[model samples]
Target: MRVIAGTAKGRALKAVPGTNTRPTTDKVKEAIFSMIGPYFDGGLALDLFAGTGGLGIEALSRGIDRAIFIDMDRISVDIVKHNVTAANVAERAEIYRNEAGRALKALEKRGSAFSLIFLDPPYRMKEMDALMLDLAERGLVEDGAKVVVEHDADHVYPETAGAFEQLKYARYGDTAVTIYRYNPVRSEHPMEE
Candidate 1:
């Protein structure tokens, strides 16, 4: 895989050394950025299930000030670190090998709110709703933050997840990507598909 845009546009990223982790394909990644942002202005990003740190690294490259990448597997974490360094974005990244739940708790304690959150958990796990609720309840996401979720096209998440409202949804074969915006103000807007 490679950085598709921004400062690290062509930088190559190494995948996790096994079949357990699936890296986001360039096509889907491009589509995701198109939905939320093809670029950003200086905000923090969180990659809760960082397979190769691609999403978070992409965020950083596109202008996010900093990013935190968390993955449960050791090999994934190591690859994320190496990829971050290779992209020359190590200074703006924080990578850790921790499960989603624990990592959120620790991020809560650290007191950093993210403006962008990427959740691309394994297809078999259906915890996106719960995880979104956790982020809202813990104030881990800043108001107006955008969350990008990648999942099986057959599985549909709710129109709303806690403080986030669905903004966009698109399907590419078996993979589906949804974008949500944190609207603590409870504003109304039509969901796009």
Candidate 2:
């Protein structure tokens, strides 16, 4: 796989060395960025289920200030490190080997709100609503942030859930990508000026 745009554009990325991790395809990656952003000004990103760190690295290359990558597999984590280094963006990346749930909880301690979140969990793990809710409840998602969910084309997520509202959806071959905008609930009563 390779970064499709930004400063790291055309930089080749290393795979996880097996079929265990499925990296996002270049075509889909390009399409995804086109939907959310072809580039960014500056923001923090979270790649939760980060396989080879392709998505997070791409975000960094696209001008995201920094990114945190989390994956449970050791091989995938190592490959992510290699890929980030190869892309010459190791300093802007924080790689961690931990399951998504634990990683989210631990991330709460950092108090970093993510403007971009990529959820590309294994296709077998169907339920993503809980994870979305957790990010909201923990305040890990910034207001108006974008959350991208990649899954099997056969499955479809809700149009709105908790603090996230679906903004875009597209299917590519067997993969389906859904983008959600996070809008935390605002108090109905306005504060007096």
Candidate 3:
């Protein structure tokens, strides 16, 4: 796959050497950016369950100041490193090989807050609800921060996950993309899906 836009636009990214990791398709990636942002000014980003660091790297290329990428697989981590280096954005990225829960806890301990958080865990995991709540409780997300979740098309998420409210949702083939924005104050009417 390749970066669809920004500074690293058009750069080809290498996939992790096995079927263990599913790379986001360029079409869906382009769609996601179109829906959330065609570009960004600057902000810190977190890519949990990062696979080859494509989403985080794309965010960096699109003007995110810095990004922390986390993945549990060694091969995926290596692939991410390679992709980051190839993009010449190593200085703006932190790549780590760790499980999602542990990484979230560490980020929480650091008292980190992200402007953008990408969640693309394995389809079978079904941990999005719990993870989103944990992120909210830990204050890991900035107020008005954007959280993007990618999952199997059949998987349905809540209209609101903790303080984050669903802003948009779309399906592309077998994949579904859900975008949420952190808003502690609730409105009289929740947004319709």
Q: For residue 110, give model 2's deviation from the true position in Å.
A: 1.4
RMSD of 2: 2.7
**Per-model C-alpha lDDT, please?**
0.91, 0.91, 0.89
Candidate 3 residue-wise lDDT, 1-193, digit = tens: 9988999999999998778899998998998888878788898999999998999999999999999999999989999999999887899999999998889889999988999999999889776978988988888988888999999999999998778889999999889999999887663344733
Candidate 1 deviant stretches above 4 angstroms: 187-193
RMSD of 1: 3.0
Cα deviation of 35 in candidate 2 (Å)?
A: 0.4
Model 2 scores worst on lDDT over the 10 consecutive residues at 184-193
- Residue pairs clashing in model 2 are none
Runs off by more than 4 Å, candidate 2: 186-193
- Tell me the TM-score of model 2: 0.95
- In candidate 1, how many Å is residue 9 off? 0.7
- Cα lDDT tens digits for candidate 1, 40-97: 9999999999999999999999999999999999889999999999999999999999
Model 1 scores a TM of: 0.95
lDDT of 2 by residue, 80-180 (tens): 99999999999999999999989988999988799999999999888887799999898899988999999999999998887688999999999999999
- In candidate 3, stretches whose alpha carbon ends up further than 4 angstroms from where it belongs are 187-193
Most accurate candidate by lDDT: 1
